[model samples]
Target: MLLGGLLGGALDLLYAFGFAASRGVAPTRLLQTIASGLQGQAAYEGGTASAALGLFSHFAMSLAWAAGFALLASRVGWLRQRPAFAGPLYGIVVFLAMRCVVLPLSAYPHPVGFPPLSTSLDLLSHMFLFGLPIALLVARALRR
Candidate 1:
């Protein structure tokens, strides 16, 4: 699970950085935005320390997600029956969990909204880059 978390989190963060870079947003700024999820708007005004907190927060989330999948896979026999399909499906579930549950419960106000296209792209990326890799890697480990 740790291995999956590291690989998947790194891949997801890289994609985030790349996407932000293309938009002329510095990577640290993006990380700070992530930190803002926890620290509120103060994260934006803060310096490298806030960005570092965001990086740590991101990996912690990844590990939690991976550990969740691992726990489910272990308890539910059906999940192990079709890892290929389950992994992608789980990705969507993860996306919803973040968008709906995590965000709303965060320091921010209730209900979440973002630009339509950006939300769509983020959901897709979470499914493919974050959730999929974690599920697939855990599935591989289970087989061993």
Candidate 2:
């Protein structure tokens, strides 16, 4: 389980880094941008502290997500048997939950100039950057 969680979290971090690379944006900058959007004024006021907190929070969230995936895979026969597809499926579920449920409920202020195209890009980015890799990793672990 620990191995699976570590692998999942590592893959997520790698995917996030890759996403930043593809966008020609520094990961720190991208995170800062996101933090700003999420936290409003304090995101910029505290600068390094805000970014650090945001990054640490993200890391912790990733670890928890990985752990949850590991636990679910262990308890769910279907997930264990078909991790490849299941992993991606799990990602999709999370994506939908965030987009349709979580974000809507939280009502966080979106950045100005964030248009529909950007929204689509963000969704696709999450799918490939976070979802796909997690799914693949989970699938691989389940295979064994």
Give the number of the best model, judged by lDDT.
Answer: 1
Candidate 1 lDDT tens digits, 16-135: 998899899999999888888899879888899999999999999989989999999888866666776776788789888888888777764334877788788777777788777877
Candidate of highest TM-score: 1
TM-score of each prediction: 0.90, 0.65
Model 2 has an lDDT value of: 0.61
Q: Which tens-of-lDDT digit does each residue in 21-82 have in candidate 2?
A: 88797777655644653575567566777677657656565566666776787788877676
* Cα TM-score of candidate 2: 0.65
Model 1 pairs in collision: none
- Candidate 2, RMSD to the unseen true structure: 4.0
